[model samples]
Target: MSRFPILPRHQSGFAYIAAVIFLVVIAGIAVVLLRLTETQQSTVNQALLASRASLAARGGIEWVFNNPVQRCSQAPLSTSNAAPAGAVNHLTDFRAESGFLVSVSCSFRAYNEGEAIDASGNSSPVVKRIYRIDAVACNGTANTCPDTGSVPRADYVERAQVATICLLTDGAPCV
Candidate 1:
């Protein structure tokens, strides 16, 4: 109030402007961080689903190898997938947490005694059986189609595995 009189126009709101700018930068950084997190989460989810599908497919192949006699069973009834009286050769499904579906099929083909026989004329009786296994695993939750006994949709991830097994060795020369 003495001789020095400060004018209102001399005061500047530079501090307020700086503060607003800082806040805006912080908000942008937060948004970017959130986006990155979401992307990472999605990637992890896809990887886990793929692993589960692979395991499901592998399980089917293992089952066929473990049960060689079942592969020689009679053909399934045309009306139903149930085993023919005593044999058990059919498609089966397995899952870990219920969202995965693994379709497994076991089939067999017989080769002549000259197929893989050794040099001797006698063929080993133990080597009489051979079987093949095919397994396909996919995510059932992504399927929108009903169970019409057809193939799964293309959108769902799928894994396939195959294995051919021979039971024993033969002595007859195979040409």
Candidate 2:
């Protein structure tokens, strides 16, 4: 007797239920997309940090080469107690500029590769000094590189670079 016809009992709230389900599915998709975007952003940020660390490490190596005091001097095996003064100062400067800690180590090896003629037309032993230089850059709370003291951070980044340099001297070792 009413103006509208009565719907079946089982299908009374069909539209409402369907709308709810659709909303839930849409929300799930949105959440997944948001998570994906966040993950991509995180990856990009990590890449940037890694690039900065690499640049810092390379800069440290260049500093070692350019600095007269640390050029061929033997680096201490452990930086816990005493690192080269020049290296430490350079690291400090870089930290201020790029918020990264850089540590540099170097070792020298000498080899005699037969003999060579000098400008004076005198033959002398060709002393080859091979310098192995290593630089480690990290964003950590530890005082030195390799960040052993601090807890693992999701945003932490580190980079290492090695450079080998050979210098030929006239029967002289690289001191």
Candidate 3:
């Protein structure tokens, strides 16, 4: 009567209700996208951690090979308390500079096991050894030998590598 026609009460709040519904839908979408992004970031971080652990394991095995003590079978590995000096089998642990722990184990076997006799068919006590080396590294804790592949915690990441190392006393001259 004064300036505009009267509107129904239900139609009065139509625009406000529509705007609220639109905002809720947008918020839901945003939350979903954020969660996806967070999940992706977590995956990437885990991958990077696993890669670091792998590098740490590789470095540990290399360190074992390059170590004169392990190569010459001179002393008990620093990580082992049960292994005797110059023992055939040994275990070692190395902590990397990047805050990771690496564990290495070597299993020794006689390369000439059944046929240790020489060309003259004379048995001689040779100083040759066959070493099978295995290494594992982790950010939190390392897996022991013969593990069942269970995750200890949500944040722990680990990697393992193995190699066949053959050390002969006659090949490399030890000083």
Q: What's the lDDT for candidate 3? A: 0.62
Q: Please, what are the lDDT tens digits per residue for candidate 1 over residues 13-122?
A: 99999999999999999999999999999888878877887787787678766755445455431222233333322243364454656666666544434333458865
Q: Estimate each model's TM-score.
A: 0.60, 0.76, 0.65
Instruction: State which candidate has the highest lDDT.
Output: 2
Candidate structures ordered by TM-score, highest first: 2, 3, 1
Give stretches of model 1 more than 4 Å off. 1-8, 72-93, 96-98, 113-130, 141-156, 168-175
Give the winner by TM-score.
2
Taken over the whole model, the C-alpha lDDT of each candidate is 0.58, 0.74, 0.62
lDDT tens digits, residues 1-175, model 3? 4798787756388889999999999999999999999999999988998888888888867876885345535544332223223322223344436666676766654443242477888975444455566777766543353233546666677788987665444544222
lDDT of 2: 0.74
- When summed lDDT is taken over every stretch of 10 residues in candidate 1, the lowest stretch is 76-85
C-alpha lDDT of candidate 1 relative to the true structure: 0.58
Candidate 3: Cα lDDT at 60: 69
